[model samples]
Target: MTKNERLFISPLPRYAYWLFLLGILISILLGLLFYRQVSAMVQHQAEAELKRLSASTSDQFQVYLQQTEYGMNQAATEQYIQTAIEKRDAEVLNQLLYGWQQNRNHAELWAILDKDARIISTLRGSSDNHNPLSLNGLALRAMASANPIVSTEIINKEELARVGRNVSDRLENHHLLKQEGVLTQLVIVPVLGKNGQVLGALCGGLVLNDNQELLRSLFGNSQAMHAVYQDKQCIAYFTNDNKVSFPEQISPAMTKSCILDGQACLGQMQSDGDTYVTVSRYIFNAQNQVIGYQVLALPQSQYSQLPAWVANISLLTGFLLAIFSIIVIGNTSRIRQLFDRERQRGQESYYLGMFAQKLQECTDENEVYLLLKKYLSRDLDVIQMEFNIISADDNCMESIRFTENDQVSRVYLNQSKCKPVLTGRINIYNDDRDLHCNQIDTDLIKSHVCIPFLAGGKVAGVVGLGSPQEQYWTPGRIEYLDAYLNLIGPTVTNIRLLKLLQAKAFEDQLTGLKNRHFLDQYLLEQLAIAERYKTTLSLLMADIDRFKLVNDNFGHDAGDLVLKEVAAVIRAAVRESDLVARYGGEEFVLVLPNTSTDEAVSLAERCRQAVNSLQVIHNDYSRIISVTISIGVASYPRDGNSLEALYKLADSALYLAKNQGRNQVRTAQEYLATLQRTGCDD
Candidate 1:
């Protein structure tokens, strides 16, 4: 053949070329299948990782709330705290509150409130340096609940300063005390007298704005975090590079879904010409009410490339194989690796399901932790485990260590050793020399791994595991531990939520006093005791005087303040053995066992006097309003024997007290005598 003809002619026949084309087509199909499989795997892994991150952040946020609540509650129980509050000792109260503030480095404000929910003393921290002593939404919510409550609502310090200016000309120089639109979480605990009456409340706040460290710890440097407050306002936002400014507004639909409906949402959102996977969760108060939303946004460009890169590698491998046409080895090792991964994934799925089921049955945090320990020790073969949970009151990490010998010890982590871990990074120490173990023998532990469990973008706790052999933490083992923590993070969070719900069931969210529900149950029990012991029982019904005027002139906020103040006064006036409850709006019921009509009348007079002396400053209008309450005393046996009869007589006497103008105390007998005297004159 001629040279040109030879170059053009095929070496094989037409049918052979068709066969070769078929083989190439098949190779392309297989390559596409490989790409799809790998991409799906990567996508699943990414989702799991993101969920873990969200769960961790949520856990940390809840821990902060719990710590704050605990701190306030603990302070409320202090003898000196009650004494300082009762004495209205500003210096002593400030001293105690300042010490508390110092103990909680991040606490922005600590204040002692009188039984009337009036701020008697306060200590402001660096977070909100100029935050004035004013009633904020958080304080109101806490006082209303009458229990330790963590607020999800954000308070605008500048707006508060402006409001204060209206109330006090002295606040004019404060210059709006720029809070920079930071969101704050407040914890309030009601202080109770020996009689279980709420004497006052202790409040602590943590400001979250420009809190770069918190954001970094929550999402790492690669992700984005933002906090949305009332009206869908973006109070705080942070990105990995610190360059991306948050949008002026987020998706209102998402916010409504999260805050109003209390549903977590995850979807793709576009911002600044880039797409992001945004996840949002509701921030709830101790009353189980959603107050805000926390959002995490991850740029799609960063993670979307992973699947493309994986597919491109698959295509490249196929191309190389087609060109070489050499018999490719089966790669048994690669097959085994895939099998192992699949097996591990299956195990994780199974264990996660099991853990969720078990956790659902748990009633408290301690039970959840015990379950986690069991799973780690048995299923995961962890030799020793240590958990260091952040303590908000102490502003430090508290450690709980479980050893192989079944010994449990509580201690604190050396700050120097766990600093990095606190920043939400996984810290691995392959050798004992690199590990810091002040409480444990480092020589006995050859390998250590520290993983941080985050809440609200900050380290809430650290999970540490140790092994006696060097290099024991393989990638597979690390993956297992991470998977286990994913389950634990959400489980612990649910446990906390359950407890809050349980508490709310029995609490009165409005007055911070025992609710009518508790009153009925408790009053009946107390009455039974009084009857069994042949003791006297006195009942007092009190109602705020001219509460309608406060509500009409100053608004409901002012009216609420009046109600809380009167409740506190009544509580303070009663004995420890007495029971007090909010009977209805602007009305309270008090039960005094082992007391006569005179004693009840005297107590009612004391409460009436206390309420008359109260000067409540409106939070919003900055108007100083005076409030008073009228009380009616009724004694069991003297005025009907049953609880219903006593309540009826007290109500009748309360009506007379109101009829003879307000702010007076009247007894059932006195009301009857007046009626009889008037009838005879007629």
Candidate 2:
């Protein structure tokens, strides 16, 4: 051997080069095998956890479901719900719900949904355990699932319908009670009738960070087991009795896995530097329908130190290090470049992974927009970043621009060179324009890229990202964005669909006013607000004083027009806080919140006058028809404290108005007293 070679060689280990190469190959192969094994083990553990916890939670959910059915059965006979159903004691139901709120911690909220999913009553408080339940969130979810008709049929189905279906059980976390606070996780269980109908769901939750006992019971006493719910969906990680939390961001991988596989998912995927064993199960109702999913995960840190193949591979490779060293020395410059490229790739990959994770966690569409801006500014090392989402239905885009001095102004999305981005059709954007990057000295416009948020197979919105000059959009970045959209799009779509469904539920198609069902709900809400604020809530009952008039005289078409016109008058007469609805044919009800009986009477009188003075052109003829309305007024804690009582008093007063003289106002108490004192002896 040459002297120089001999000097470089280690005297004790001559077979080191061959052994090192062999070890490298073995290490990679063995490590992969170990990883797979660990993954399997983790999956097994996660499934076991899900089976155990899901069983427990499912049981709890069932109990609530039972309670709801029982309530429905009772309400069928009970005066409160029955009256509300028959529109006889509508105010009574509201009073009960208000009283029920006082003892909220006792149980979950139980509601009776009409064909529309509007809450009729909630025995328990909301997920936040404070605010009265509103259809804003739940209706969206209900609408997304089967249509409203399903409930009518379901209500009549047998208990057997609960069998063999994946019953949904999940937690809802939101800043409902404390504004600007961490999301609170609440458990929601649906109440399905024996006839395969959903009466309403029982919604209640364990206070986040409060019920450690229950948490440990479900997830085990593990620091890694943490549960969080977003928009009625949940994700949790468990380790022993302690729990760790998942960020409220969703990842592209998770999103894809969820949609492709279904909501309840369990898998071991690449994230950060370690592998985690995860188990996800979808929450379902008593009918075994999908609600949301629960995720149980274990970090690799827990089992990484175990005697696995990766450690063995490393141990075996050490003996062959010298052989690899010799080979590596022959190509030093190439190795350096390779290492640099890998490092760059690694950094980019890390950011992308984080971005994916956050994307999956987000529930609201707007959150996606905010995340894009943040990632471009922080992860991409951009000087200035701005983005806008073009509303497919409306012009919804934000803009920002940059000058030569790196001075950035938030330009609108409309001002950006959007043609290329629109052409790319990618859901994520970064600086992909070569010309823009080369020409711009400022960071804001240099690395501009845009991604569209698609819903229902169409571009519903766009997300744009940017960095400083000469930025190139790589396939990796595009892939990263595509991954994010894969997760975000469905969630956005679901939310949108949910809103549409809810809107359909409470709306009257012909008159475009709140329906009878909606009126009941609104009355309940107003009653509670009035009680809380100790203010008056006045109800005005007005019936179109006429000949069945428009319908009988001008046909049903003219009657429909009169109804529409009357609705418009009521809508205009009431403040936003007031509730207006078509109580029945030719009769309308207006609930004026925080209004006194005098105010309600005055409001009703105005409505009557408006109707009487209005001219209706039937059959394209300017036919001036004088229509009049009989008005009745009732106030809370005076006329009655209950919805039913108030309504009854109003109706009685309305009867008196009709009896004495049409288009006049009257009170139930006064008329009733007069009736008792002066009996017309025939």
Instruction: For candidate 2, write residues 1-682 as lDDT tens digits.
Output: 8999889876657689778677777765655555556556544544544444433444433333343333223333332343353342324444544433332333323344333444444332221222334332443355345222111111111111111011112222322212222222233334444454544443333233223344554334223444434323333333452223454443434434442245455555344455665545554434455434455555645433233443444456553334333433433444346446545644554554556556545545556656655665564545544444455355545554434453445544552456534664653334344534322344355555556656656665555555554535677666655554544554455445434545655788888987888899889988998899999888888888874856777788788887788788768766787778888888888888888777877777777777777776767676755577888888897879899998888898898899888878887666677678888421
Per-residue alpha-carbon lDDT of model 1 for 57-97, expressed as tens digits? Answer: 56556655565565456557655567667877777666566
Report lDDT (CA) for all predictions: 0.65, 0.53
Worst 10 residues of 2 by lDDT: 149-158
- Native-vs-model 1 lDDT? 0.65
Q: Highest TM-score among the candidates is held by which one? A: 2
- Give every collision pair in model 1: 56-454, 57-455, 57-456, 60-454, 60-455, 61-455, 61-456, 146-512, 195-576, 218-457
- On lDDT, the leading prediction is 1
For all candidates, the clash counts are 10, 74
